[model samples]
Target: MSVYTEVGRDQLIAFLADYAVGELVHYQGISDGIENTNYFVTTDKGEFVLTLFEHHDFGELAYFLDVMTFFFEHGIPSAHPAADRQGRYLKKLCGRPAALVMRLDGRGVANVASLAQCEAIGDILGQMHIAGQQFQSRRHSQRGPEWRQETAQRLLPMMEADQAALLKNELAFQKGYADLDLPWGVTHSDLFRDNALFDGEELRGIIDFYYACDEYLLYDLAVAVNDWCVDESGTLALRHYQALMSGYLQHRQLTDAEQANWNLVLRAAALRFWLSRLQDKLFPREGEITQIKNPDAFLKILQQHRHQPFSVDELQ
Candidate 1:
């Protein structure tokens, strides 16, 4: 989360008046993500995260908060929102929608995830997908198919020839499976390594539900696998892949259709991140970023998926 909006001590203290979080001791801006402003907030009462929405409005954020609540209620290890004295989770802060969530334990492993960490991520994701079956409300991703297509088109003009060709062919291939009926539910849509926290090999919690939406459950797993189970060079790590799948299967089993489209799902997941990172690179956002993600990483991942394609069975 980028610190787009800066909150002064007085401003934060005044805002905390609505809640019972006690007097603020200190707060520091968190610059790990791109879409939102996050600060590690501490008070006499407890530690929490303060998020100022950059792209989403008050109304649009309700779904994400509700999703957080749902996950919390379902015993999922996720960041849960702290309600104000008035029992409201969504509130206003410095002219933007904001909310405070109990900060989860542990640090992000990022690109150094081990085999056991991969299995933990997969197990938790499987459990989340299963619990999502009970979710009554559904919302399509803001970054869904239409947005991806439009983004790819916009980025094509700015891409190298090889990249452009790969983008076009992948989009065409992905379009064919758009209507395929696979196991679908609430998806964490962006469960990269940084989004999940770990205390050593033990998973503490999954944070950043901002990208959570209704989509193919398998796609969610693929997104996690892409980030958590890949080597530095973007190649699949066999031991990690098998470990992840093994953990996932402990919670839920895949359908025949999901198995049939497994490799394609992996490829689709690769393209989505590649296109998004490319878009971010070309149309640079004006902000202070802790680290801007590299598009070339996803490019390499996509190329690996395409050239050395493997089935779910192979990975398992």
Candidate 2:
């Protein structure tokens, strides 16, 4: 949701004319994320998010738009992609592939303060996974093991010997679990606390589906735990972790393989973010508002997961 491309007022008004959303009142650039150019668009009808795709092609963008529609139709609390008079969600805006989605109510929780909040996120995530089972479109995770390895190799030369070794070792460790059979489905691969909207302790919406893909269900849970149930020091908060798992299990129980490889998945999740952040920090794109998250944060998380592995029973 960074501003990579700038949109002029006149240009934006003309673009909005293609849709029935209403006359554009105002629009402001959103700078919380790093992938795409996003703006909070306000029109006479209501508020919406206008996203200009930075890297994705039209076909990829259409898949994501369909995924959002599928989630919304299945009772998942997510933004609905707006269509034009021609009933088309994809359009060319600012000379880039773009789409408009309804702006969900409530703000994203930056500093998750309660176990109840973690639980709520977990419950919703489980429901989302279940709903995604019926979605026919299949896209492999862009940040999966192969990407992690390639990224780590590229970043290795830029880091200290110890950091390079850790990166290599973690990638090797993740490879051991590559073929493990687990319940797989469409997953919100990046479900950090900031991606979820909370009205008090209840979750109002989950936004940012750009990273959604077909992946292991447990891996999705692991990614959530790595973010939502971790403290400032990147240590796993046991109570919060437990609450999250409990809530998820209420909706969909994990398979035997998932339970057995839970700790491994946690480590893999940590490694994924660590590598991505390092890449973003080292090779930042030219954006109007570029935010490079700290790679060290995920490094600490990876170290913790490596040193202190926990099981599903421990969370129970």
Q: Could you give the C-alpha RMSD of every candidate to the true structure, in order shown?
A: 1.1, 1.0
RMSD of 1: 1.1
- CA lDDT of 211 in candidate 1? 90
lDDT tens digits, residues 1-316, model 1? 8887888889999989999889899899997977888999999999999999988988789999999999999999999999999999988998989999999899998567888998998899889988999998778877767877999989988888987888898888888656878989898899988898999999999999999888889889889888888887999989988888888899999999998998888888888888887777788677654446788998888889889888887777
Candidate 2 per-residue C-alpha lDDT over 1-316 given as tens digits, one digit per residue, 9 for 90 to 100: 8999999999899889999989999899998978899999999999999999999999998888888899999999998999999999999988899999999988887785589998998899889988888999999889988888888889999999999888787877788766989989899899988889889887889899999999999999999999988898989899998888888888898888888998889888888898888899999899877778998999999899888887888768
Cα lDDT, all candidates = 0.87, 0.89
Task: Evaluate model 1: give its lDDT.
Answer: 0.87
Residue 204 C-alpha lDDT in model 2: 85
Provide the lDDT at 88 for model 1. Answer: 96
Instruction: List TM-score per model, in order.
Output: 0.97, 0.98
Name the weakest run of 10 consecutive residues (lDDT summed) in model 2: 169-178
TM-score of predicted model 1? 0.97
Checking candidate 1 for backbone clashes, the offending pairs are 1-33
Which number leads on TM-score? 2
